[model samples]
Target chain A: MTTQASSTAIDAEAAGTVPRLSLNRWTFRTTPVQEFLEATTSRGIEAVGLWRQDVEEVGLDALRRRVDDAGLRVSSLCRGGFLTASAEADRAAALDDNRRAIDETAALGAPTLVMVVGGVDRADKDIVGARARVTEAITELAPYAEQRGVSLSLEPMHPMFAADRAVLSTIDQALDIAEASGSSAVGVVVDTYHVWWDPSLERAVQRAAASDRLLAYQVCDWNLPLAAEPLHSRGYMGDGFIDFPAITRMIAATGFTGDIEVEIFNENVWATPAEESARIIAERYQELVLPYA
Target chain B: MTTQASSTAIDAEAAGTVPRLSLNRWTFRTTPVQEFLEATTSRGIEAVGLWRQDVEEVGLDALRRRVDDAGLRVSSLCRGGFLTASAEADRAAALDDNRRAIDETAALGAPTLVMVVGGVDRADKDIVGARARVTEAITELAPYAEQRGVSLSLEPMHPMFAADRAVLSTIDQALDIAEASGSSAVGVVVDTYHVWWDPSLERAVQRAAASDRLLAYQVCDWNLPLAAEPLHSRGYMGDGFIDFPAITRMIAATGFTGDIEVEIFNENVWATPAEESARIIAERYQELVLPYA
Candidate 1:
């Protein structure tokens, strides 16, 4: 027993020697998946947050092989919700696809599968109804996700996206749904760029930690002039006004010891080489986040 | 007593006949104050929201006379805070100016004076401190406002303005300060363009109403392809996807039977004759808010 315990302690120590910081795939969406992986690996990043399209193009087997060969961890999968389909068939298909995504995340050895509960379809003016549908869909999908050994992370996007992207706009709102869903398997992603402006942020973070609903912490900066095309205009970390160290301290206060994922959706960053972006992010993680550790 | 009661009822009915819509002076920043008011009053607008600059240019007394002669209600005076100054002298100056503004609002018979608590001075990184300064300034000036019978409306602007404009970004946050200040004179202005995107909006509105913290309800639209300059790019009602009728219904649910002020700060609207702009907003308000009513 002592020998086994010592071996475990040594393994833990080895693991601690190399810190993990995740690079969200959207940061380099302009690059091919294989190239991105190769570049990121070259920069000594051991973890990645991937998108569905990237996996689809590379094929799951190829992705699995690449991740394994490069000794990389799949922190979280990019997306799988858009659950606001107008038709029953469409909604059913979206759910089925989400289940598949859960399977994929589990297959890739990722713990959390991200969900972006889609906005009201153009013809639908009932935002409340749309939100209800999102909650129901997640409730239904929770069992499947649990069965696959994957946690579902619902991302409440910025309020600007309430009409067309994701109806969930605040962490507290997301937590309400997560609590009502009655599943520890379903949780939420706390993205700084989307929620840094929320006045209830500290309270929400504490609540999320207390509920064990904080599945991931995604980092990015809030640009000075929020772009007309909000999806592509996210600022890179340290480039904009968000208090990152403060957020990290808040997250840590919750006893959350998880991967601090860098998620930028900047057009300028996306257009750059994946390796350069990964290196920049990794360097920032060390400079900004290391002190907290 | 019965005759007086009957007369009051008759006056209320007459006031109710004209839909309560006020043009925020910032909407016509480019136009001369006299021309703006003259055009708006001629277009049958019953109320106007004035700015300090507008009052200053036209001379507050002259503007007051013009409003009286035109039989227009000064729904709200545009602004009075900018209280987040670095130095004691600057802070004192802001408070003194706000006192003058309170006097002006009283002269114009404006029920509310809008307060946009300014952001941190560029060199300062203390937003929380700036907010503290704003609270202190407001507290100092609240007595003057109360004596003059002018309610000080704290306008919590959108989060995009957290750095350069108002630090208060949520209705709940504003209400907390309003309650803390121990002054009924200080309340909040609920602007649709700013607060519509808040996920906890309904609850915030209800809370504000319950506490009698709702001093004003301003209306405008959130346009997609958010204009090049967001500060002045608000859309007119029905032009954007904001659920106006639903929001108005929520506001009414709060038992806030206040003026539905039409405060659109749009470059498109402001560039035109103020009368045309006021007419357009009045028509939109009637079309959108009346249905909800």
Candidate 2:
């Protein structure tokens, strides 16, 4: 599988095409939606991962029309999961917001609604309990997503964000939740930046694939000394310690033909012009990642 | 097991005693070793986990004699594993240093030498390769450690440290490595700050206990907005989002009677006077952790 995919990707690149490349808009958060879409399309990138706030900025209908006009595939909606709210009102608001995110995902024709399960609540030291709440929330959202013909792709974030951003911190845990949701709408993402350090990644990815739950394959490098914001510390592929060939091969081996999205969260990358960032993403993805994926 | 241990701890604390509270020296790295020891003993902390640099400062023999004279139990040595060195000479030197650390652990009458298996090498991007090297190093050191009657405790550091500090990033991975070492001298440390985010932690802790590989239980809280030096970002037990009672119960349920070492690495905590830090450790451990442990 890897051999065939590697050769095909190489052949396509040699023919002057960026194969399987998708630009996740957060990679250039400074760019407005219109320009970001224009930049992505100008570079021949056919797909993008959209964030909820960005969608809201232009309004979902306007953004959907623009994405359609650009002929860009919405790979996956950027978020909709903070399900760890302890207060009844907050929990309701979160779920209601997630429901709206699912509607937006369906409207945008995105197959998956990327979910970052909420971290431990303030005044709640129970991470396990918080994870349980996330699981429950996923169960609740799964049916709605299935009804909308969209999948809820659970993103197990880096454990550094486990306390305050997302308690779901491993592919195994995400897969478990996805399976337990018992709705085919539930799935898991294989984001290199998040799960690259995972020891059982190959096995987890295999399991995710076997279960048909591998929704998105996002690429980014894990950088050091973490940015002052930490969340924006991700580097461009090949610029950091992640062995893209090894990890990408593992994902590619799963026979996953999904868009290979570049979702770097670096402030430096964000500061770069969208076109330049798109060019680098294509270049790095071809050199470091495409051969494997 | 949890009920009995929990009640016993509660009873002990009700009698005005801080049970199972061992002060890990790095908690207050600013204090001189002599004053650190004095402060520890003065606070009625019966055991301590020592750092190699601190021991080297006063010389091993002198520190050993002083600890013995103070009637302090050495729970475990701070560290001895940088097995991710890619060069042959560096690898040999790291093993030799670990052997010396095993000797130091024996000399101090500490049962275990904590091992922080190194992260990716300077020019290497292969984390999986680094982990395999760490496993090989542990296998090689196990017999020598067994000869010295000191266990090599593999500590799975937080994933945040996976890039630059330790590739060993989960309790399950550490336990797997320990088992593969095929020596009783190989064990694992359960450090809350590192593994608290683990969704499989309870099961992993149980596996460690079932295999009799639970060598050390270190307590510290997971603080956010990580300090500039992330290594020093750990907070006092109750100050962060970690649910001490829950995590402590998991350890205590393992029937682990070893010293529950307090190993905070926060700058503010380090700046506090050693006496005050010790007092706070005792107080926090008793309140947030002891009953569960």
Q: Which candidate is the best by lDDT?
A: 2
Off by over 4 Å in 1: A1-18, B1-17, B85-90, B120-126, B273-275
Write down the worst ten-residue block by lDDT for model 2 chain A: A1-10
Estimated TM-score per prediction? Answer: 0.90, 0.96
Q: What value does DockQ give for candidate 1? A: 0.45
lDDT of 1 by residue, B1-293 (tens): 12322333345346654356677777778787777777776665667788888677788889889888877788899888899888989888888888888998898888999998887565444566777887777778888888998898999887767767888888988888888788898899999888877767899888988888888998888776667777765878877767887888898777676676777777778678766776777667666764463
Q: How does each model score on lDDT?
A: 0.79, 0.88
Residue by residue across A151-204, what tens digits does model 1's lDDT show?
A: 999998877687788988889888988988889998889998888767778899
The CAPRI quality class of candidate 2 comes to: high
Error of 1 at A281 (Å): 1.8
Return the top candidate by TM-score: 2
lDDT of 2 by residue, B1-293 (tens): 23434666667656755667899989979998889989987877788899999778888889999999988999999899989988999999999999999999999999999999989975878888899999999999999999999999999999989989899999999988998999988989999989999988999999999999999999898887788888877999888898888888788788888889999888899789999999988888877877677
Clashing pairs in 1: none
TM-score of chain A of 2: 0.96
